[model samples]
Target: MAKRAPGLGAVQETMLITLHARARCGDEAAARLVEAIDYDFAPMQRNAGATELFHVLRCAALDEWTRQFLAECPHGTVVELGAGLSTRADRLDNGTAHWCYVDLPDATELRRALLPDGERRRTITGSVLEDGWADAVAADPGPYLFLAEGVLVYLEPAGVRRALTTVATRFPGCRVALDTHGEWIVKRSRGPLTRMAADLVWACEDPKALQDWDLGLTLRESWPLSRPDWVVRRALPRHTRLTLAAVNAFVPRRMTNSRVNLYSVDATG
Candidate 1:
């Protein structure tokens, strides 16, 4: 468990819990992160609208993906950017493999209190835009998976481009999976939720532009929340595949399909 300290914000604390929860099923590292945090996550998680349901759903999808990846990529290294208290290591830890949790210095300081630090499933603290961090990661030679989660959009386009290029050039056979916001969603919406989202991260006009930047547009899957086939997909996690299918049959067409951009970077240079 992580040792506790003062000055950590509740919002950051909650984000950590989300990561741990996603890692709960098979991610022992994630579970350890939860137990390590000094703050209470119940207030945010249990509340009606404190945390976004869709975010949790996204976490579910990623958790499933992480487990499947570990099964297929033994000895491959996995790196989590902006790894705020996320125990993805707990969920995807392979004793023989390497896992690097990277983030900013302040967040790293806070994370150190909640996570164990050392090589082999280690944590690297630095701004994702910086060159030094990439240089360090480039030292690891193996099939790598860069899991950015909800972090890509926070970076300006140049930073995002540089980071991806750096990784692709340094590591061979590396893949990345991350979420993105639609340009339309950002420009058209003026509601409270829209503004709140903008306050949290920068917006992009086109997610598909990733390919132009040399990042392979691997699997462009959409998690449409309002389609006839959406409900069952969400329900299948608890092995409620049948229930999810049943619900999908009756779902409406008007629901918002928040666009998620996932890319797979090939690091074979």
Candidate 2:
């Protein structure tokens, strides 16, 4: 599909679907699941090339992490922050859990093309920074995993804080897993390498900035979600590892987060 008209800036949307298309294709069930969802135009293709590889790698990591979470947590809810045209539900559908697609209204419009309105799997068409959307999700036990794959940097730093604060409040004791960029992105802004790495986004020098907003999230793990095996297996085997590493080099090296350190009487605490 063509990219969403410029201003809507569906860069996250495009990246997710391309990741869905390329990464989810790993298994037949996943491929069928992806084929089942309709993709927004151009969100993936418009930015395909090297940058898209990061999208693919991240999607794979997300899929693996989701699988891990479900196996570990009981009937957990998987909230895809800025879930644009991604068939993540297809790859990791376990019938018994809840899967919510979160994103802007326009991106959801593109998502509805394939996802359809449903029962177990549904859509929350709003920025994660907003409220109400959390209320829309069915309540589960403590420590919900709010995942933000490639959406945070595009948001104003404060917007990200608001989103985290909301999630931390709504789901007390919830742990979040997200990917973020490093200090170098904000500090060094020059050359094609910078352009290749930084294209319309912001990075954080310290991971704890989320806590500064009074959100009760704590850092869990911050390791590279790199997959040397998968990269080596790609058709262009020659450059896949090098390519993946080059992209990953820009990511903050640890699992940066703030946990539900202490819960106030209100979930918002």
Q: Rate the local accuracy (lDDT) of all candidates.
A: 0.58, 0.58
Global Cα RMSD, each model: 5.1, 6.6
Cα error of candidate 2 at position 204, Å: 1.3
lDDT tens per residue, model 1, 1-269: 34565244432333554554444444566665556556555544444231244455556556555665678887777788777777666555777668788877767777776666766767787777765677666666566777776666556778778777766666646667666565544344432233223333446545566777655545544454222134435554644454444445764322233444445665445
TM-score of each: 0.71, 0.68
Using alpha carbons, what is the TM-score of model 2?
0.68
Q: For all candidates, what are the clash counts?
A: 9, 21
Evaluate residue 142 in candidate 1 and report its C-alpha lDDT on the 0 to 100 scale.
Answer: 62
Q: Which candidate comes out best when scored by TM-score?
A: 1
